[model samples]
Target chain A: MDDRPGAPRQNASEEIEALITLMAKLPGLGPRSARRAVLHLVKKRALLMTPLADAMHNVAASARECLVCGNISGAEVCHICRNEKRATGEICVVEDVADLWAMERAQVFGGRYHVLGGTLSALDSIGPEDLRIPKLVQRVADEGVSEVILALGATVDGQTTAHYIADALEGTGARLTSLAQGVPIGGELDYLDDGTITAALRARRSF
Target chain B: MDDRPGAPRQNASEEIEALITLMAKLPGLGPRSARRAVLHLVKKRALLMTPLADAMHNVAASARECLVCGNISGAEVCHICRNEKRATGEICVVEDVADLWAMERAQVFGGRYHVLGGTLSALDSIGPEDLRIPKLVQRVADEGVSEVILALGATVDGQTTAHYIADALEGTGARLTSLAQGVPIGGELDYLDDGTITAALRARRSF
Candidate 1:
């Protein structure tokens, strides 16, 4: 018997094993935790367990990704893409679907989003074509998008991707903006570098 | 036009609304977060979304409560109940199935579990019948269980339920043993009341 981390237990059903495998892949969870979680969901079938399972099934049957902006949807285009009111000549570009949703939860941005799936990573052999950069450029022209807000992370890859996108959209006459840096977010001001502080200070306008 | 939190936009579907409603009820999730989670799942259908949904549907269709111990199951009795190896002389009793699973994760005990479902609570109109006390007693005799280990919480209702079960099982030839109480379990021990401390001390024996 192999002693690998999260190895499948002997004599378990394929379905149960599959559940354990998938659950183990979830963030902050492992094989042991997955087993425990699956057991729990199975036990609370009427109240919590069933509903969660039903939700998973319904989503499985209907879920699809929006080809235009990389947002997940039940159809070819997501609800955000279908909404004419959201087409406000501005596109907020994000690094991941989760980040896009986080922005949506704030309810401050009235414009729609374009998910990049991930930032530029030379180490990972990821190039511009690997991301949704081409589609974003196509959207700028087709949708008459005026402003592109870069909501990438502060990481090197995130900055590189933001710059790459900024350069790509230069000919389209679309203004590029990014989320502010060097702010004491969640009370972690002490972690800021001098470069970040300097860049934030230089970028500071009237606001 | 209600001002309540998490009110969906007028264009959202009833199914989507229902999904959002149920998602909102989940632990660590609220209405706004639920909306975002649903959106993310729907979009990632082929990868992150569809499989999750499929798993949910399968579980939902087959899930049922174990008639014997109130554990979640896909049949008349749970896997624990069906397993012959688990029919040891000792039964580890718990306030809920979650607690039962916690003990299982620890893997110290080889005996079966008795899920009381919940603790005794006067504030919520809960009583012995509201729990699985009667079923537990019956099982002790029917299964020839020699020892009944009480692994309930140290809360007021938890202690009350434990004592109630101890009294009910008197002279049934089943030795009742509660989990130790000296340690600051579920919290630091200094926070416990003097009466609880005294009782725990009196109940203490040679390890």
Candidate 2:
């Protein structure tokens, strides 16, 4: 059906269409935005498009999951995992590497991290074995970790995963804890939901 | 000034950061959305990231502007310009290749096109010489184009460019015309701007 009597029409060249289609696959970009991005890239072929293409190529060739923590890094083991000073006897467990990066951006935790990759989900048949849970358990025992902070989300699956990990490491003698749920800093009490208000009141401390 | 005493901390590896920075430069993608996109790309490295990178590289290497019409294509000339059946003695002028693609999508015009590259701008110091005005004149003369339709925007610069081209092609014997100024299809009169309403009223047609 190369050129039938009534073949489907194409808007632009196949190469441009292919670029737009792939651009649409990225997070937060739809078909319309992908088309706009493609046009913009074509307009700035040398300055933006070629450099972006090169960057994507380099990242694709080099980026790999850290063997120790599951965070995406340029090396087999990420910088945090390789840093001896970051081992601080604590490993913050997060559901995704994005969350790990978020924590790092805040510069709050000095210890290393263990990305769970995902929380337990019975509906999707995702279990502890499916994620980095086993590796987390092994790290706790081998590394003599003193504390395992569950910085996972407050969703039901997140809590279930946290509790499951706590039970899994019962004999490891590591102190297990989770992030507190409450009114966020700079949050208005009037805007908060009842659950948040209740949690903040229950976890309240002296002024 | 890397690793100096109290240097600024970085959240992710340099490669990942570079990818995010480049991604943020894309249209409709800000820093936050770019970070999310980079994370998604990293997670699907083999499936999506590699293919996208390859696509971009190929497009960047192969894509070129059509020598005659200024449309981006893999070949020296675009399919539209090369299609003998599309030589309908009419040339539709547009502001950009994106607009040319839009016209192709509509599939209303059955003739060739001329991409003006950009509109005339006095504030930005853009002149007729900066655009494809000379080339359009040569095309109108050499290609024996009978009707030159100006499909530029309603903006001041777009109108100014259209008028300039009209004056430039006065003795070329090509009938100079423009897209009708009216309320757009599916547009409400109440929601329309004053200038559009005035134009529509002045150029009103009989039922």
Candidate 3:
């Protein structure tokens, strides 16, 4: 006999539990959210879950990192790296694939991208060799890149990586620049942080 | 040349976009969260995404509704309905499969469940026939059920449904009861609504 007072005699099947565990590991999801997502998927299996499964299967089997730029793709090289029209002698550097995707969403930069994988972190024992900095320098030299845009974050590690990249590419003659810091569009001054306010003030322009 | 200022030369591949669209439609996910989940899945394809895909495929292919109850399962009758040890002479009625799952999570209810799918809503033109009421009545008469626990929400439609079920079961010997309304565990009094406080006060038991 089951000892628990109100507990169900049986729990969810092992397969379901395994799926929920894996889902909980996803970004922005915890155990509760994962359980909810799995239930929703199960309820809409025919309409949503089956198609999602197929898509995941396809991507999992085919997805690979671009050899030249490190962006994710179904081929040896990502589309952005292969696009001749985007070979505009400029390469935007970002920390991770998510940032690369974000830059793609903005649709502003017209050149290619080089994903650094992560910033140089001393605490984590990450160094220049751990990242794609050497490959970036090589790309700049081989591809005759005119500029390297460091679109890194304002965090300490981000700044450290940016400076390191600048020093690494000093002799390569490729002009290096970082994204300008300022108040975001539609941002309230009262809510703005001191660093942002100071940066906005320093980079202030005539209206 | 691409006309968009900062837009990527190309958007995500068709398969990826399809996956993102389906993911966005899930209960807790939106477009941005869906994108992040998809990217995380892509990055962890070997360890997480592949297994998740397989689990979903298996569940999608085999999952079905219990014939006796409306709970989701891999079998026709579901494990709970088939378990003879769980025949506790009680049926906890709920509005949806999610509610059933929640009750199961609590591990308090030891009886079977009858999912109503939805409440009787005059505003939405939903009547007793639209839900599993007739089936529930048939179950109570045929299955030797003694008690019917109404685990439905504390809404007007829920109360209306409970009363309607009671009326239907008047000839039968099944006793009907609803979940007690009260302030939830760890819930702040300041945050609780008037109705909850009143219910908690009215149902107060001696120490």
- In terms of lDDT, the best-performing candidate is 2
- Selected candidate, larger DockQ, 1 vs 2: 2
lDDT string, candidate 3, A1-207, tens digits: 222444334456656766777888888888778888988888888988889889898888888889998988878988888889899999999999889878877778889999999999999999999999999999999999999999999999999999999999999989998999999989999999999999999999999
Residue range B22-57, candidate 2, lDDT tens digits: 888888998778989999998898889888887887
Question: lDDT tens string, model 1, B95-139?
Answer: 776676567655578788888989899999999998999999899
Could you say which candidate leads in TM-score? 3
By summed lDDT, the worst window of 10 consecutive residues in model 1 chain A runs over: A1-10
- What number of clashing residue pairs does each candidate have, in the order they appear? 7, 0, 8
Off by over 4 Å in 1: A1-24, A28-54, A83-88, A105-112, A182-207, B1-21, B28-44, B79-88, B181-207
Compute DockQ for each candidate against the true complex. Answer: 0.20, 0.49, 0.53
Q: For residues B1-207, could you state the per-residue lDDT of candidate 3 as single tens digits?
A: 212444434445556766777878877888788888999888888998889899898888877778898888878888889989789999999998878878887778889999998999999999998999999999999999999999999999999998898898888899888898898999999999999999999999998
Candidates' chain B TM-scores in the order shown: 0.82, 0.94, 0.92
Per-candidate local distance difference test? 0.74, 0.88, 0.87
Root-mean-square deviation of every model? 5.2, 3.8, 3.4
Model 1 pairs in collision: A43-B72, A53-B56, A56-B53, A57-B53, A72-B43, A73-B43, B184-B189
Model 1 residue A146 lDDT score: 91
**TM-score for chain A as predicted in candidate 2:** 0.94
Q: Which scores better on TM-score, 1 or 2?
A: 2
Best by DockQ: 3
As a whole number from 0 to 100, the lDDT of residue B164 in candidate 3 is 92
Which has the better TM-score: candidate 2, or candidate 3? 3
